[model samples]
Target: MNDNILNTDREELVARLIDRPESFTDKQLEQILADDECRALYDTAIQVMHSIEPKLETNVEAEWNRFSMLHSRYRRSQRKWWKVAAMLAVVLMSGLAYATIQHMKQETWSEQKATESIVSDDTTTKTTENKQDTMQVQTSIAQPRTFENTSLDLLVGVLAEHYGMRVQVMNDEAGQLRLYYEWNPALSIEQVVDQLNTFEKVNITVNDHTLTIE
Candidate 1:
Protein backbone atom coordinates (compact mmCIF):
# COMPACT_ATOMS: atom_id res chain seq x y z
CA MET A 1 0.00 0.00 0.00
CA ASN A 2 1.03 3.62 -0.66
CA ASP A 3 2.38 5.59 2.35
CA ASN A 4 -0.26 8.32 1.95
CA ILE A 5 -3.07 5.77 1.84
CA LEU A 6 -1.68 3.99 4.90
CA ASN A 7 -1.49 7.28 6.79
CA THR A 8 -5.08 8.18 5.91
CA ASP A 9 -6.31 4.78 7.10
CA ARG A 10 -4.33 5.14 10.34
CA GLU A 11 -5.81 8.60 10.96
CA GLU A 12 -9.33 7.31 10.40
CA LEU A 13 -8.64 4.34 12.68
CA VAL A 14 -7.39 6.64 15.47
CA ALA A 15 -10.49 8.87 15.17
CA ARG A 16 -12.80 5.85 15.36
CA LEU A 17 -10.83 4.56 18.35
CA ILE A 18 -11.58 7.76 20.25
CA ASP A 19 -15.23 8.15 19.20
CA ARG A 20 -16.38 4.52 19.00
CA PRO A 21 -13.73 1.89 19.65
CA GLU A 22 -16.29 -0.83 20.25
CA SER A 23 -17.66 -0.40 16.72
CA PHE A 24 -14.41 -1.45 15.03
CA THR A 25 -14.99 -4.29 12.54
CA ASP A 26 -13.08 -7.56 12.97
CA LYS A 27 -11.02 -6.80 9.85
CA GLN A 28 -10.15 -3.31 11.16
CA LEU A 29 -9.19 -4.67 14.57
CA GLU A 30 -7.01 -7.24 12.87
CA GLN A 31 -5.25 -4.49 10.89
CA ILE A 32 -4.69 -2.49 14.07
CA LEU A 33 -3.34 -5.56 15.85
CA ALA A 34 -0.92 -6.29 12.98
CA ASP A 35 0.41 -2.74 12.56
CA ASP A 36 2.75 -1.33 15.28
CA GLU A 37 1.86 2.29 14.44
CA CYS A 38 -1.87 1.64 14.67
CA ARG A 39 -1.44 -0.11 18.04
CA ALA A 40 0.57 2.86 19.37
CA LEU A 41 -2.11 5.31 18.17
CA TYR A 42 -4.82 3.15 19.79
CA ASP A 43 -2.95 3.14 23.11
CA THR A 44 -2.47 6.93 23.04
CA ALA A 45 -6.13 7.57 22.17
CA ILE A 46 -7.31 5.27 24.96
CA GLN A 47 -4.97 6.99 27.45
CA VAL A 48 -6.22 10.50 26.53
CA MET A 49 -9.90 9.52 26.58
CA HIS A 50 -9.65 7.76 29.93
CA SER A 51 -7.78 10.68 31.47
CA ILE A 52 -10.29 13.37 30.40
CA GLU A 53 -13.43 11.38 31.31
CA PRO A 54 -13.05 8.23 33.33
CA LYS A 55 -15.78 5.65 33.82
CA LEU A 56 -17.05 5.04 37.33
CA GLU A 57 -16.98 1.24 36.97
CA THR A 58 -15.02 -1.05 34.69
CA ASN A 59 -15.14 -4.85 34.35
CA VAL A 60 -11.61 -6.04 33.62
CA GLU A 61 -12.49 -9.65 32.77
CA ALA A 62 -15.44 -8.77 30.54
CA GLU A 63 -13.45 -6.17 28.60
CA TRP A 64 -10.53 -8.53 28.06
CA ASN A 65 -12.89 -11.28 26.81
CA ARG A 66 -14.61 -8.88 24.43
CA PHE A 67 -11.28 -7.65 23.05
CA SER A 68 -10.10 -11.25 22.63
CA MET A 69 -13.28 -12.21 20.75
CA LEU A 70 -12.95 -9.22 18.39
CA HIS A 71 -9.83 -10.69 16.75
CA SER A 72 -9.45 -14.46 16.92
CA ARG A 73 -5.74 -14.10 16.12
CA TYR A 74 -5.22 -11.50 18.90
CA ARG A 75 -2.74 -13.88 20.61
CA ARG A 76 -0.72 -14.88 17.53
CA SER A 77 1.94 -12.17 16.99
CA GLN A 78 0.45 -9.26 18.98
CA ARG A 79 0.02 -10.61 22.52
CA LYS A 80 3.18 -8.89 23.82
CA TRP A 81 2.25 -5.58 22.14
CA TRP A 82 -1.25 -5.79 23.62
CA LYS A 83 0.11 -6.26 27.16
CA VAL A 84 2.59 -3.42 26.74
CA ALA A 85 -0.09 -1.14 25.32
CA ALA A 86 -2.43 -1.83 28.24
CA MET A 87 0.33 -1.08 30.79
CA LEU A 88 1.32 2.12 28.95
CA ALA A 89 -2.35 3.20 28.83
CA VAL A 90 -2.70 2.79 32.62
CA VAL A 91 0.53 4.71 33.39
CA LEU A 92 -0.28 7.55 30.98
CA MET A 93 -3.82 7.96 32.34
CA SER A 94 -2.53 8.05 35.95
CA GLY A 95 0.16 10.63 35.09
CA LEU A 96 -2.27 12.96 33.29
CA ALA A 97 -4.82 12.74 36.12
CA TYR A 98 -2.18 13.56 38.74
CA ALA A 99 -0.92 16.54 36.75
CA THR A 100 -4.46 17.94 36.34
CA ILE A 101 -5.18 17.64 40.08
CA GLN A 102 -1.87 19.36 40.95
CA HIS A 103 -2.64 22.26 38.63
CA MET A 104 -6.07 22.78 40.20
CA LYS A 105 -4.55 22.71 43.70
CA GLN A 106 -1.95 25.35 42.72
CA GLU A 107 -4.65 27.69 41.38
CA THR A 108 -6.77 27.23 44.51
CA TRP A 109 -3.79 27.99 46.78
CA SER A 110 -3.00 31.20 44.83
CA GLU A 111 -6.58 32.44 45.18
CA GLN A 112 -6.57 31.67 48.91
CA LYS A 113 -3.32 33.62 49.42
CA ALA A 114 -4.76 36.64 47.57
CA THR A 115 -7.90 36.59 49.73
CA GLU A 116 -5.86 36.39 52.94
CA SER A 117 -3.71 39.34 51.89
CA ILE A 118 -6.74 41.57 51.21
CA VAL A 119 -8.44 40.64 54.50
CA SER A 120 -5.24 41.19 56.49
CA ASP A 121 -4.73 44.65 54.99
CA ASP A 122 -8.31 45.68 55.68
CA THR A 123 -8.06 44.51 59.30
CA THR A 124 -4.75 46.33 59.77
CA THR A 125 -6.22 49.55 58.36
CA LYS A 126 -9.13 49.48 60.83
CA THR A 127 -6.79 48.82 63.73
CA THR A 128 -4.46 51.62 62.66
CA GLU A 129 -7.39 54.06 62.45
CA ASN A 130 -8.48 53.16 65.97
CA LYS A 131 -4.94 53.65 67.35
CA GLN A 132 -4.66 57.05 65.64
CA ASP A 133 -7.97 58.11 67.17
CA THR A 134 -6.72 57.13 70.64
CA MET A 135 -3.45 59.01 70.14
CA GLN A 136 -5.30 62.13 68.97
CA VAL A 137 -7.35 62.14 72.19
CA GLN A 138 -4.16 62.12 74.34
CA THR A 139 -2.31 64.74 72.25
CA SER A 140 -2.81 68.53 72.17
CA ILE A 141 -5.45 70.02 69.88
CA ALA A 142 -2.88 72.58 68.62
CA GLN A 143 -0.75 69.85 66.90
CA PRO A 144 -1.78 68.62 63.40
CA ARG A 145 -1.70 64.89 62.65
CA THR A 146 1.06 63.88 60.20
CA PHE A 147 1.35 60.77 58.02
CA GLU A 148 4.78 59.18 57.51
CA ASN A 149 5.70 55.79 56.00
CA THR A 150 2.02 55.07 55.33
CA SER A 151 0.88 52.89 52.47
CA LEU A 152 -0.62 54.91 49.60
CA ASP A 153 -3.71 52.68 49.61
CA LEU A 154 -4.29 53.27 53.34
CA LEU A 155 -3.73 57.03 52.93
CA VAL A 156 -6.22 57.18 50.03
CA GLY A 157 -8.78 55.23 52.04
CA VAL A 158 -8.44 57.57 55.04
CA LEU A 159 -8.78 60.68 52.84
CA ALA A 160 -11.81 59.27 50.99
CA GLU A 161 -13.64 58.43 54.22
CA HIS A 162 -12.83 61.77 55.97
CA TYR A 163 -13.93 63.92 52.97
CA GLY A 164 -16.99 61.81 52.03
CA MET A 165 -15.44 61.12 48.60
CA ARG A 166 -14.76 58.04 46.50
CA VAL A 167 -11.09 57.27 45.72
CA GLN A 168 -10.16 54.99 42.83
CA VAL A 169 -6.76 53.64 41.76
CA MET A 170 -7.34 53.58 38.04
CA ASN A 171 -4.27 51.77 36.68
CA ASP A 172 -1.19 49.70 37.52
CA GLU A 173 1.11 52.62 36.68
CA ALA A 174 -0.26 54.53 39.68
CA GLY A 175 1.94 54.94 42.77
CA GLN A 176 1.97 52.20 45.39
CA LEU A 177 4.38 53.53 47.97
CA ARG A 178 4.50 55.07 51.44
CA LEU A 179 3.85 58.78 51.99
CA TYR A 180 5.82 61.12 54.24
CA TYR A 181 4.07 64.43 54.79
CA GLU A 182 2.11 66.54 57.23
CA TRP A 183 -1.66 66.10 57.10
CA ASN A 184 -3.86 69.21 56.93
CA PRO A 185 -7.48 68.64 57.94
CA ALA A 186 -8.50 71.95 56.32
CA LEU A 187 -7.41 71.00 52.76
CA SER A 188 -10.15 70.13 50.27
CA ILE A 189 -10.39 66.60 48.83
CA GLU A 190 -8.80 67.78 45.54
CA GLN A 191 -5.82 69.34 47.29
CA VAL A 192 -5.35 66.24 49.43
CA VAL A 193 -5.42 63.99 46.38
CA ASP A 194 -2.93 66.29 44.67
CA GLN A 195 -0.65 65.93 47.67
CA LEU A 196 -1.00 62.18 47.40
CA ASN A 197 -0.03 62.31 43.69
CA THR A 198 3.73 62.10 44.27
CA PHE A 199 4.55 60.07 41.12
CA GLU A 200 5.61 62.12 38.06
CA LYS A 201 4.02 59.75 35.53
CA VAL A 202 0.64 59.41 37.25
CA ASN A 203 -2.39 61.60 36.49
CA ILE A 204 -4.73 62.54 39.33
CA THR A 205 -8.27 63.77 38.79
CA VAL A 206 -10.73 65.07 41.34
CA ASN A 207 -14.31 65.67 40.17
CA ASP A 208 -16.88 66.74 42.76
CA HIS A 209 -17.11 63.77 45.16
CA THR A 210 -14.77 61.38 43.31
CA LEU A 211 -10.98 61.17 43.09
CA THR A 212 -9.17 59.03 40.52
CA ILE A 213 -5.45 58.22 40.25
CA GLU A 214 -4.12 56.68 37.05
Candidate 2:
Protein backbone atom coordinates (compact mmCIF):
# COMPACT_ATOMS: atom_id res chain seq x y z
CA MET A 1 0.00 0.00 0.00
CA ASN A 2 2.93 2.38 -0.65
CA ASP A 3 0.71 4.10 -3.22
CA ASN A 4 -1.75 4.99 -0.41
CA ILE A 5 0.70 5.29 2.50
CA LEU A 6 -0.83 8.39 4.08
CA ASN A 7 -4.44 7.18 3.77
CA THR A 8 -4.35 3.56 5.18
CA ASP A 9 -6.82 2.60 7.97
CA ARG A 10 -6.00 0.38 11.05
CA GLU A 11 -7.54 -2.77 9.48
CA GLU A 12 -5.56 -2.36 6.23
CA LEU A 13 -2.29 -1.76 8.09
CA VAL A 14 -2.70 -4.60 10.67
CA ALA A 15 -3.73 -7.07 7.94
CA ARG A 16 -0.72 -6.22 5.82
CA LEU A 17 1.75 -6.34 8.79
CA ILE A 18 0.51 -9.76 10.03
CA ASP A 19 -0.39 -11.52 6.73
CA ARG A 20 1.80 -9.67 4.22
CA PRO A 21 4.86 -8.14 5.97
CA GLU A 22 6.73 -8.22 2.56
CA SER A 23 4.07 -5.88 1.16
CA PHE A 24 5.65 -2.97 3.19
CA THR A 25 8.59 -1.17 1.55
CA ASP A 26 11.32 0.33 3.83
CA LYS A 27 10.20 3.88 3.03
CA GLN A 28 6.55 3.05 3.83
CA LEU A 29 7.51 1.34 7.13
CA GLU A 30 9.63 4.37 8.12
CA GLN A 31 6.74 6.70 7.40
CA ILE A 32 4.42 4.60 9.64
CA LEU A 33 7.02 4.54 12.49
CA ALA A 34 7.51 8.30 12.23
CA ASP A 35 3.87 8.71 13.37
CA ASP A 36 3.88 7.81 17.13
CA GLU A 37 0.24 6.74 17.38
CA CYS A 38 0.47 4.68 14.15
CA ARG A 39 3.68 2.96 15.38
CA ALA A 40 2.07 2.04 18.76
CA LEU A 41 -1.00 0.63 17.02
CA TYR A 42 1.22 -1.35 14.61
CA ASP A 43 3.25 -2.91 17.48
CA THR A 44 0.11 -3.78 19.49
CA ALA A 45 -1.49 -5.49 16.47
CA ILE A 46 1.62 -7.67 15.93
CA GLN A 47 1.66 -8.80 19.61
CA VAL A 48 -2.08 -9.53 19.72
CA MET A 49 -2.11 -11.48 16.43
CA HIS A 50 1.01 -13.54 17.31
CA SER A 51 -0.35 -14.36 20.78
CA ILE A 52 -3.73 -15.65 19.41
CA GLU A 53 -1.99 -17.78 16.74
CA PRO A 54 -4.71 -18.05 14.08
CA LYS A 55 -4.97 -21.56 12.59
CA LEU A 56 -4.36 -21.62 8.85
CA GLU A 57 -4.95 -25.41 8.37
CA THR A 58 -7.56 -27.00 10.66
CA ASN A 59 -7.28 -30.73 11.69
CA VAL A 60 -10.81 -31.06 13.07
CA GLU A 61 -10.57 -34.52 14.76
CA ALA A 62 -7.15 -33.89 16.25
CA GLU A 63 -8.24 -30.53 17.73
CA TRP A 64 -11.33 -32.12 19.24
CA ASN A 65 -9.36 -34.94 20.88
CA ARG A 66 -6.82 -32.49 22.31
CA PHE A 67 -9.54 -30.28 23.76
CA SER A 68 -11.28 -33.32 25.29
CA MET A 69 -8.05 -34.53 26.93
CA LEU A 70 -7.33 -31.06 28.48
CA HIS A 71 -10.94 -30.73 29.69
CA SER A 72 -10.81 -34.23 31.27
CA ARG A 73 -7.55 -33.44 33.11
CA TYR A 74 -9.02 -30.16 34.39
CA ARG A 75 -12.07 -31.97 35.72
CA ARG A 76 -9.93 -34.57 37.49
CA SER A 77 -7.79 -31.92 39.19
CA GLN A 78 -10.92 -30.01 40.23
CA ARG A 79 -12.37 -33.13 41.86
CA LYS A 80 -9.11 -33.83 43.79
CA TRP A 81 -8.56 -30.22 44.92
CA TRP A 82 -10.15 -31.05 48.29
CA LYS A 83 -7.43 -33.69 48.95
CA VAL A 84 -4.70 -31.14 48.27
CA ALA A 85 -6.42 -28.60 50.52
CA ALA A 86 -6.73 -31.19 53.32
CA MET A 87 -3.01 -32.10 53.06
CA LEU A 88 -2.00 -28.41 53.31
CA ALA A 89 -4.21 -28.00 56.37
CA VAL A 90 -2.64 -31.03 58.05
CA VAL A 91 0.89 -29.72 57.31
CA LEU A 92 0.01 -26.30 58.77
CA MET A 93 -1.45 -27.92 61.91
CA SER A 94 1.68 -30.04 62.44
CA GLY A 95 3.93 -26.98 62.06
CA LEU A 96 1.85 -25.06 64.60
CA ALA A 97 2.00 -27.96 67.09
CA TYR A 98 5.78 -28.28 66.74
CA ALA A 99 6.22 -24.53 67.16
CA THR A 100 4.04 -24.50 70.27
CA ILE A 101 5.99 -27.37 71.85
CA GLN A 102 9.33 -25.65 71.12
CA HIS A 103 8.01 -22.37 72.56
CA MET A 104 6.96 -24.14 75.75
CA LYS A 105 10.38 -25.78 76.09
CA GLN A 106 12.12 -22.41 75.64
CA GLU A 107 9.92 -20.78 78.29
CA THR A 108 10.62 -23.61 80.73
CA TRP A 109 14.38 -23.33 80.17
CA SER A 110 14.25 -19.56 80.66
CA GLU A 111 12.33 -19.96 83.93
CA GLN A 112 14.91 -22.47 85.17
CA LYS A 113 17.75 -20.10 84.38
CA ALA A 114 15.93 -17.24 86.13
CA THR A 115 15.39 -19.33 89.24
CA GLU A 116 19.05 -20.40 89.32
CA SER A 117 20.23 -16.79 88.90
CA ILE A 118 18.05 -15.61 91.79
CA VAL A 119 19.41 -18.35 94.08
CA SER A 120 22.99 -17.55 93.08
CA ASP A 121 22.48 -13.84 93.84
CA ASP A 122 20.98 -14.65 97.24
CA THR A 123 23.92 -16.93 98.11
CA THR A 124 26.47 -14.25 97.12
CA THR A 125 24.65 -11.58 99.12
CA LYS A 126 24.58 -13.79 102.22
CA THR A 127 28.28 -14.61 101.88
CA THR A 128 29.23 -10.91 101.57
CA GLU A 129 27.02 -9.95 104.57
CA ASN A 130 28.61 -12.68 106.77
CA LYS A 131 32.15 -11.47 105.97
CA GLN A 132 31.26 -7.86 106.82
CA ASP A 133 29.62 -8.89 110.13
CA THR A 134 32.74 -10.89 111.13
CA MET A 135 35.02 -7.91 110.40
CA GLN A 136 32.81 -5.53 112.47
CA VAL A 137 32.81 -7.91 115.47
CA GLN A 138 36.61 -8.24 115.39
CA THR A 139 37.05 -4.45 115.29
CA SER A 140 34.68 -4.00 118.25
CA ILE A 141 36.61 -6.53 120.42
CA ALA A 142 40.00 -4.73 120.34
CA GLN A 143 40.02 -1.66 122.63
CA PRO A 144 42.73 0.85 121.66
CA ARG A 145 45.15 1.98 124.43
CA THR A 146 46.14 5.64 124.32
CA PHE A 147 49.21 7.15 126.05
CA GLU A 148 49.38 10.97 126.03
CA ASN A 149 52.94 12.01 126.95
CA THR A 150 53.69 8.57 128.45
CA SER A 151 57.37 7.64 128.81
CA LEU A 152 58.56 5.21 126.08
CA ASP A 153 60.14 2.87 128.66
CA LEU A 154 56.86 2.31 130.56
CA LEU A 155 54.84 2.10 127.34
CA VAL A 156 57.24 -0.50 125.90
CA GLY A 157 57.16 -2.47 129.17
CA VAL A 158 53.30 -2.68 129.13
CA LEU A 159 53.18 -3.65 125.44
CA ALA A 160 55.92 -6.27 125.83
CA GLU A 161 54.19 -7.75 128.86
CA HIS A 162 50.83 -7.87 126.97
CA TYR A 163 52.39 -9.89 124.13
CA GLY A 164 54.66 -11.96 126.43
CA MET A 165 57.67 -10.42 124.64
CA ARG A 166 61.18 -9.56 125.92
CA VAL A 167 62.26 -5.89 125.72
CA GLN A 168 65.89 -4.73 125.14
CA VAL A 169 67.01 -1.06 125.36
CA MET A 170 70.29 -0.25 123.55
CA ASN A 171 70.64 3.19 125.19
CA ASP A 172 69.14 4.84 128.28
CA GLU A 173 68.20 7.87 126.14
CA ALA A 174 66.04 5.79 123.80
CA GLY A 175 64.38 3.96 126.69
CA GLN A 176 63.54 7.20 128.50
CA LEU A 177 62.16 9.01 125.40
CA ARG A 178 58.63 10.24 126.24
CA LEU A 179 55.89 9.89 123.53
CA TYR A 180 52.30 10.75 122.77
CA TYR A 181 50.79 7.73 120.93
CA GLU A 182 47.75 5.48 120.74
CA TRP A 183 48.61 1.77 120.73
CA ASN A 184 45.98 -0.45 119.18
CA PRO A 185 45.98 -3.98 120.61
CA ALA A 186 44.30 -4.92 117.33
CA LEU A 187 47.70 -4.52 115.56
CA SER A 188 50.31 -7.33 115.51
CA ILE A 189 53.41 -6.97 117.76
CA GLU A 190 55.60 -6.44 114.71
CA GLN A 191 53.28 -3.67 113.47
CA VAL A 192 53.42 -1.96 116.91
CA VAL A 193 57.25 -2.21 116.80
CA ASP A 194 57.32 -0.60 113.36
CA GLN A 195 55.14 2.30 114.59
CA LEU A 196 57.42 2.83 117.57
CA ASN A 197 60.47 3.08 115.30
CA THR A 198 58.84 5.99 113.40
CA PHE A 199 59.71 8.28 116.36
CA GLU A 200 62.98 10.29 116.39
CA LYS A 201 66.10 8.19 117.28
CA VAL A 202 63.90 5.14 117.96
CA ASN A 203 65.09 1.99 116.13
CA ILE A 204 63.11 -1.06 117.20
CA THR A 205 62.37 -4.54 115.80
CA VAL A 206 60.68 -7.71 117.06
CA ASN A 207 61.68 -11.26 116.14
CA ASP A 208 60.45 -14.42 117.88
CA HIS A 209 58.81 -12.36 120.65
CA THR A 210 62.08 -10.53 121.29
CA LEU A 211 61.67 -6.71 121.03
CA THR A 212 65.07 -5.16 120.23
CA ILE A 213 65.63 -1.36 120.55
CA GLU A 214 68.69 0.47 119.28
Candidate 3:
Protein backbone atom coordinates (compact mmCIF):
# COMPACT_ATOMS: atom_id res chain seq x y z
CA MET A 1 0.00 0.00 0.00
CA ASN A 2 2.82 2.49 0.68
CA ASP A 3 4.53 1.64 -2.67
CA ASN A 4 1.31 2.42 -4.53
CA ILE A 5 0.97 5.77 -2.76
CA LEU A 6 4.64 6.67 -3.54
CA ASN A 7 4.19 5.77 -7.24
CA THR A 8 1.01 7.91 -7.46
CA ASP A 9 2.78 10.87 -5.91
CA ARG A 10 5.70 10.55 -8.38
CA GLU A 11 3.31 10.34 -11.35
CA GLU A 12 1.42 13.48 -10.18
CA LEU A 13 4.62 15.44 -9.65
CA VAL A 14 5.99 14.45 -13.11
CA ALA A 15 2.71 15.46 -14.74
CA ARG A 16 2.68 18.81 -12.90
CA LEU A 17 6.33 19.54 -13.95
CA ILE A 18 5.56 18.71 -17.57
CA ASP A 19 2.64 21.19 -17.47
CA ARG A 20 4.64 23.90 -15.68
CA PRO A 21 8.37 23.36 -15.45
CA GLU A 22 8.79 26.39 -13.09
CA SER A 23 6.28 24.93 -10.64
CA PHE A 24 9.13 23.33 -8.60
CA THR A 25 12.31 24.99 -7.35
CA ASP A 26 15.65 23.41 -8.34
CA LYS A 27 16.23 22.15 -4.77
CA GLN A 28 12.69 20.62 -4.61
CA LEU A 29 13.07 19.14 -8.14
CA GLU A 30 16.43 17.60 -7.10
CA GLN A 31 14.91 16.27 -3.92
CA ILE A 32 12.03 14.69 -5.86
CA LEU A 33 14.43 13.16 -8.45
CA ALA A 34 16.58 11.65 -5.62
CA ASP A 35 14.32 8.57 -5.72
CA ASP A 36 15.13 6.22 -8.65
CA GLU A 37 11.42 5.64 -9.38
CA CYS A 38 10.64 9.37 -9.32
CA ARG A 39 13.72 10.08 -11.50
CA ALA A 40 12.61 7.38 -13.98
CA LEU A 41 9.13 8.90 -14.14
CA TYR A 42 10.53 12.37 -14.78
CA ASP A 43 12.86 11.05 -17.56
CA THR A 44 9.87 9.33 -19.24
CA ALA A 45 7.85 12.58 -19.01
CA ILE A 46 10.74 14.55 -20.58
CA GLN A 47 11.00 11.98 -23.36
CA VAL A 48 7.26 12.29 -24.04
CA MET A 49 7.54 16.06 -24.06
CA HIS A 50 10.44 15.84 -26.57
CA SER A 51 8.56 13.36 -28.72
CA ILE A 52 5.51 15.63 -29.05
CA GLU A 53 7.46 18.95 -28.87
CA PRO A 54 6.82 19.96 -32.53
CA LYS A 55 3.05 19.41 -32.18
CA LEU A 56 2.93 21.31 -28.86
CA GLU A 57 4.79 24.31 -30.31
CA THR A 58 2.84 24.42 -33.60
CA ASN A 59 0.76 27.68 -34.21
CA VAL A 60 -2.47 26.72 -36.02
CA GLU A 61 -3.65 30.31 -36.37
CA ALA A 62 -0.35 31.46 -37.88
CA GLU A 63 -0.42 28.65 -40.47
CA TRP A 64 -3.99 29.58 -41.33
CA ASN A 65 -3.00 33.22 -41.79
CA ARG A 66 -0.16 32.24 -44.18
CA PHE A 67 -2.53 30.00 -46.22
CA SER A 68 -5.09 32.83 -46.49
CA MET A 69 -2.43 35.26 -47.64
CA LEU A 70 -1.23 32.85 -50.33
CA HIS A 71 -4.80 32.33 -51.54
CA SER A 72 -5.36 36.08 -51.73
CA ARG A 73 -2.14 36.53 -53.75
CA TYR A 74 -3.18 33.77 -56.19
CA ARG A 75 -6.58 35.38 -56.70
CA ARG A 76 -4.99 38.75 -57.33
CA SER A 77 -2.62 37.24 -59.92
CA GLN A 78 -5.53 35.55 -61.70
CA ARG A 79 -7.47 38.83 -61.85
CA LYS A 80 -4.43 40.63 -63.21
CA TRP A 81 -3.99 38.02 -65.92
CA TRP A 82 -7.67 38.29 -66.86
CA LYS A 83 -7.44 42.05 -67.13
CA VAL A 84 -4.40 41.80 -69.40
CA ALA A 85 -6.18 39.29 -71.61
CA ALA A 86 -9.25 41.49 -71.87
CA MET A 87 -7.15 44.50 -72.83
CA LEU A 88 -5.37 42.53 -75.54
CA ALA A 89 -8.66 41.27 -76.91
CA VAL A 90 -10.09 44.77 -77.10
CA VAL A 91 -7.01 46.09 -78.88
CA LEU A 92 -7.08 43.24 -81.38
CA MET A 93 -10.74 43.77 -82.19
CA SER A 94 -10.32 47.49 -82.60
CA GLY A 95 -7.40 46.99 -84.97
CA LEU A 96 -9.40 44.59 -87.07
CA ALA A 97 -12.38 46.95 -87.22
CA TYR A 98 -10.15 49.84 -88.21
CA ALA A 99 -8.49 47.78 -90.89
CA THR A 100 -11.84 46.67 -92.27
CA ILE A 101 -13.10 50.27 -92.46
CA GLN A 102 -9.92 51.41 -94.17
CA HIS A 103 -10.16 48.61 -96.68
CA MET A 104 -13.76 49.51 -97.44
CA LYS A 105 -12.84 53.15 -97.91
CA GLN A 106 -10.06 52.19 -100.31
CA GLU A 107 -12.43 50.01 -102.28
CA THR A 108 -15.02 52.80 -102.49
CA TRP A 109 -12.44 55.26 -103.75
CA SER A 110 -11.22 52.81 -106.36
CA GLU A 111 -14.78 52.25 -107.59
CA GLN A 112 -15.44 55.98 -107.79
CA LYS A 113 -12.27 56.53 -109.80
CA ALA A 114 -13.19 53.69 -112.14
CA THR A 115 -16.67 55.15 -112.69
CA GLU A 116 -15.22 58.56 -113.45
CA SER A 117 -12.81 57.05 -115.96
CA ILE A 118 -15.64 55.22 -117.73
CA VAL A 119 -17.78 58.39 -117.90
CA SER A 120 -14.84 60.40 -119.25
CA ASP A 121 -14.20 57.80 -121.91
CA ASP A 122 -17.85 57.87 -122.95
CA THR A 123 -17.85 61.66 -123.18
CA THR A 124 -14.72 61.60 -125.33
CA THR A 125 -16.23 58.94 -127.60
CA LYS A 126 -19.43 61.03 -128.06
CA THR A 127 -17.40 64.17 -128.90
CA THR A 128 -15.33 62.22 -131.46
CA GLU A 129 -18.49 60.82 -133.10
CA ASN A 130 -20.04 64.29 -133.46
CA LYS A 131 -16.88 65.69 -135.01
CA GLN A 132 -16.70 62.76 -137.44
CA ASP A 133 -20.30 63.36 -138.55
CA THR A 134 -19.60 67.07 -139.28
CA MET A 135 -16.38 66.23 -141.20
CA GLN A 136 -18.22 63.60 -143.33
CA VAL A 137 -20.91 66.12 -144.32
CA GLN A 138 -18.30 68.72 -145.29
CA THR A 139 -16.21 66.17 -147.25
CA SER A 140 -19.25 64.93 -149.20
CA ILE A 141 -20.03 68.49 -150.38
CA ALA A 142 -16.37 69.24 -151.32
CA GLN A 143 -15.93 66.12 -153.49
CA PRO A 144 -17.30 65.55 -157.03
CA ARG A 145 -19.77 62.83 -158.15
CA THR A 146 -21.10 61.90 -161.66
CA PHE A 147 -24.78 61.20 -162.31
CA GLU A 148 -25.50 58.87 -165.27
CA ASN A 149 -28.98 59.54 -166.73
CA THR A 150 -30.49 60.10 -163.31
CA SER A 151 -33.82 61.82 -162.77
CA LEU A 152 -33.92 65.53 -161.80
CA ASP A 153 -35.83 64.60 -158.68
CA LEU A 154 -33.10 62.11 -157.58
CA LEU A 155 -30.35 64.64 -158.29
CA VAL A 156 -32.16 67.40 -156.51
CA GLY A 157 -32.85 65.12 -153.55
CA VAL A 158 -29.17 64.22 -153.20
CA LEU A 159 -28.09 67.88 -153.50
CA ALA A 160 -30.68 69.05 -150.96
CA GLU A 161 -29.53 66.51 -148.34
CA HIS A 162 -25.90 67.74 -148.61
CA TYR A 163 -26.60 71.50 -148.96
CA GLY A 164 -29.67 71.83 -146.67
CA MET A 165 -31.92 73.31 -149.36
CA ARG A 166 -35.62 73.11 -150.33
CA VAL A 167 -36.58 72.29 -153.92
CA GLN A 168 -39.75 72.89 -156.04
CA VAL A 169 -40.75 71.89 -159.58
CA MET A 170 -43.13 74.03 -161.71
CA ASN A 171 -44.70 70.88 -163.09
CA ASP A 172 -44.37 67.13 -162.43
CA GLU A 173 -42.71 66.62 -165.86
CA ALA A 174 -39.58 68.45 -164.69
CA GLY A 175 -39.14 66.02 -161.82
CA GLN A 176 -39.07 63.14 -164.31
CA LEU A 177 -36.43 64.80 -166.53
CA ARG A 178 -33.31 62.62 -166.83
CA LEU A 179 -29.86 64.16 -167.00
CA TYR A 180 -26.29 62.88 -167.40
CA TYR A 181 -24.05 65.35 -165.63
CA GLU A 182 -20.74 65.42 -163.71
CA TRP A 183 -21.67 67.48 -160.64
CA ASN A 184 -19.24 70.04 -159.25
CA PRO A 185 -20.23 69.91 -155.58
CA ALA A 186 -17.97 72.99 -154.98
CA LEU A 187 -20.19 75.18 -157.26
CA SER A 188 -22.93 77.32 -155.76
CA ILE A 189 -26.59 76.41 -156.32
CA GLU A 190 -27.04 79.64 -158.43
CA GLN A 191 -24.17 78.62 -160.76
CA VAL A 192 -25.66 75.18 -161.16
CA VAL A 193 -29.02 76.81 -161.89
CA ASP A 194 -27.40 78.90 -164.72
CA GLN A 195 -25.84 75.71 -166.13
CA LEU A 196 -29.22 73.95 -166.03
CA ASN A 197 -30.85 77.03 -167.67
CA THR A 198 -28.70 76.33 -170.80
CA PHE A 199 -30.26 72.85 -171.06
CA GLU A 200 -32.90 72.19 -173.76
CA LYS A 201 -36.37 73.17 -172.57
CA VAL A 202 -35.05 73.40 -168.90
CA ASN A 203 -35.13 76.45 -166.66
CA ILE A 204 -33.85 76.40 -163.05
CA THR A 205 -33.52 79.21 -160.54
CA VAL A 206 -32.61 79.67 -156.89
CA ASN A 207 -33.77 82.23 -154.31
CA ASP A 208 -33.63 82.32 -150.48
CA HIS A 209 -31.68 79.05 -150.51
CA THR A 210 -34.53 77.35 -152.49
CA LEU A 211 -34.07 75.67 -155.89
CA THR A 212 -37.02 75.80 -158.42
CA ILE A 213 -37.29 73.91 -161.72
CA GLU A 214 -39.45 74.66 -164.78
Best candidate (score: TM-score): 3
RMSD (CA, Å), candidate 2 to true, equals: 44.9
How does each model score on lDDT?
0.65, 0.73, 0.71
Q: Give lDDT tens digits, candidate 1, residues 80-177.
A: 88789889979988986897689567656755775778877555655665687577544633345556455566666777777788888876445465
Question: For model 3, where is the 10-residue window of minimal lDDT?
Answer: 1-10
Provide the lDDT at 94 for model 3: 100
Model 1: per-residue Cα lDDT at residue 151: 56
lDDT of 1 at 128: 69
- Clash count, candidate 3: 0
Ranking by lDDT: 2, 3, 1
Residue 95 lDDT in candidate 1: 89
Q: Model 2, range 80-194, lDDT digits (tens) per residue?
A: 7868877997998899789769966765676577577787765565566569768865674467976645677788888888788998877778887767667898788888888
- Candidate 1 runs further than 4 Å off: 1-143, 173-175, 198-202
Residue-pair clashes per prediction, in order, are 0, 0, 0
TM-score for each of the candidates? 0.31, 0.34, 0.40
> Could you give me the TM-score of model 3 versus the true structure?
0.40
Instruction: Please list the Cα RMSD from the true structure of every candidate, rounded to 1 decimal place.
Output: 30.5, 44.9, 54.3
